[model samples]
Target: MTGSRGPAAASAWIPLVVTVTLVQAVLALMSRALPLFGMPLTASSGMPPEAVGQLSSATSLGSMLFFLWGPALLVRLPSIRQLQLGCAVSAAAMLFCAAGRWEGLLIAAFGIGLGYGPSTPAGSDLLMRVTPKHLRATVFSIKQAGVPLGGLAAGLLLPAVAAFFGGVDAALVTAAVLALVAAAALGFWKGTVDDARPAASAASPFRHLLLAPVRLIGLLVHAPRLRLITAAGFCLGVAQGVLMGFFPVFLSDHAGWSLTAAGAAFAVLQGLGVGGRVVMGWMSDRLGDPVRALSGICLASGLTMALLASIGPGSSPLWVIVLSSLAGLTVVSWNGVFLTGLAEAAPEGRVGEITAGGTFVLFSGYVVCPLLMQAVIAATGGYAIGLILAGLAPAIAGLALMIGAGRRQR
Candidate 1:
């Protein structure tokens, strides 16, 4: 077993994780607030749905660009420095978002995406470099939990801030200020950690990502188990986007829950996801095969979501709460296992590239799922079909992972 280290070494990562988590949470809340901000812009300026989609996609596009190029750039720079740069960029993006102009919003989205995009792979690399392999899964789970934890924070806090302040713009500005503070903290943080060495001299980010090794890794990421896990992530993203996107409508029209209640419920659901992530990660570590743990969680989550859909509107408040909590737990629990597996499977010296490649593919699911869910809802006149379809996708993903795990065992 890898022995435990000194407190100074272990505690080194605490501040970084906390800052990243807070940034992510604030960004997510801001992202959710975009539609509200966009409504007036769309109504007055006649902005096309496609343009709105572009604005939404800007962050992902920036992330894609960063992931494709960041590995090589970061190889030369210290991980802490890279994180600081990312934080600065993210802060600037938020400032632009606060400007409240349509063009500014788009630019801000792109900036934020580019700035924060490298955090995932960069952070993962740092954790791997410092933490022992045996504890890697658990550490990663704790780190990954930040995503849901941030979501929960946004769910609970942003709405309250917005409500109290009389608009989301004020809340966004406040979030931006916080991001700036985090960036400052990152910039000044002093920690001693080894840096990853690159295999070759730097090349164009686009070229590096398209090369054989990276492409091969990207293809490998589609292995049955990984594919299923990624698909589950996609489904979860869809559920998140749609549930949050149309939440007010759902509450008023179907559930008869007030906007305040809906907001509170959404916060609770996201908060529960934090626990889910930790539990799933711990279980995966103890079970010795993260894939199996992932499969179980995905299967359970999918079925529970389906049941929630079946119950429909006007279900008991208690049932709604229970279903939402279960869904949160299962849906958000897959990332640690999936990501840790990807990190482990990567080529000896190309872990960053492999991680970037894998995450790029996985995030594609996020882009597609929401659009599909909305289309289904529009066509069917309710979320029932969409929810059922979403449920099945994860189950299929679970089966794929089970097969992949079997193959590995052999």
Candidate 2:
């Protein structure tokens, strides 16, 4: 993508990593910007919370759609262009969000999600190709750290920008400028960091779209191991979705913590996740078997979820923070390791396709789990009931991964 036709030089990793990490951070910021940016956008535009939900749904659906077809587009476009395109889409989304009414925000959110869709998989495709095998997990984890760092940035920067600009316009513009700068930088670089495959041959786009579903179904039906692993990833997604959606509320509502305190706790959880991803990733590499190591981590994090569920309002505040930290470390840290594990297990040369498929299933959790958690909470009228169920997700995932690893060993 950057270079002519050659693979990226090893020394190019520094800028490449920085650029991709920034991409991740930007997308992460967008994903988390709802309360920060979303609130202001809604207020200024006179949109209701229900409208915001529709906007969020649009984003997630856009992401899922891209995850399904992103790699195909990747093949058709230069990786550099792909990276820049993702940023551009997000830029457009942010601009629309800052100015557009509810309808505009809904469309903008979809653009944002679709734009972010190709980033990780494309980045992963590059990392797996460029980095040495031993370093993949650590390096990927470093890239993955962008998510938490992005969250941290949104927390620290967006508010000040909004306050400074006296509106969300200046903040969104700043975000857009950052993405454009990154995209421009990659364009100027002479290295070929992303030119992995030849452009898609002259073929009808519809033919490509028509065949995607058939090929996807075939990929799973023909590969039982991949299917099981994908299913397990879906479970991880459920655990991730539930906790991400519910943790702050649970802290405030059930644990009787103030909103500020709960938000602070959530920030700490995100901070911990930044370190947790690296630690878990390094451990997976050191153990030399990501699947088994991830299994253990999943089990450990699941226990922390259970611990959180057991902590009622009368429980010590410090203990809740402690358990939250544990969950943050174990549950939130799994993505890099999980991505590495999925890559390791993919059929040779099929990593990109598998990554797309796995991501689709993973995102399904984001769509399904929170709704399920909400229903469970509503039915039981207790946070613990839903949380206990959330706790089971990772445990189930660990079991599935452990069994899969054992079968591979045999």
Best lDDT goes to which candidate?
2
lDDT of 1 by residue, 124-223 (tens): 7666655667777776777777666665666566667777986666766666665667666656544444333334556676575456446645556556
Model 2 segments more than 4 A misplaced: 1-8, 35-57, 99-105, 160-177, 188-191, 195-197, 201-203, 249-262, 310-317, 404-410
All-Cα superposition RMSD per candidate: 4.1, 3.7
The local distance difference test score of model 1 is: 0.63
On a 0 to 100 scale, what is the lDDT of residue 267 in model 2?
71
Question: How many clashes does the backbone of model 2 have?
Answer: 4
Clashing pairs in 2: 1-195, 2-191, 3-191, 3-192
In model 1, which range of ten residues has the least summed lDDT?
35-44
Shift in Å, residue 25, candidate 1: 4.0
Residue 402 displacement in candidate 2 (angstroms):
3.0
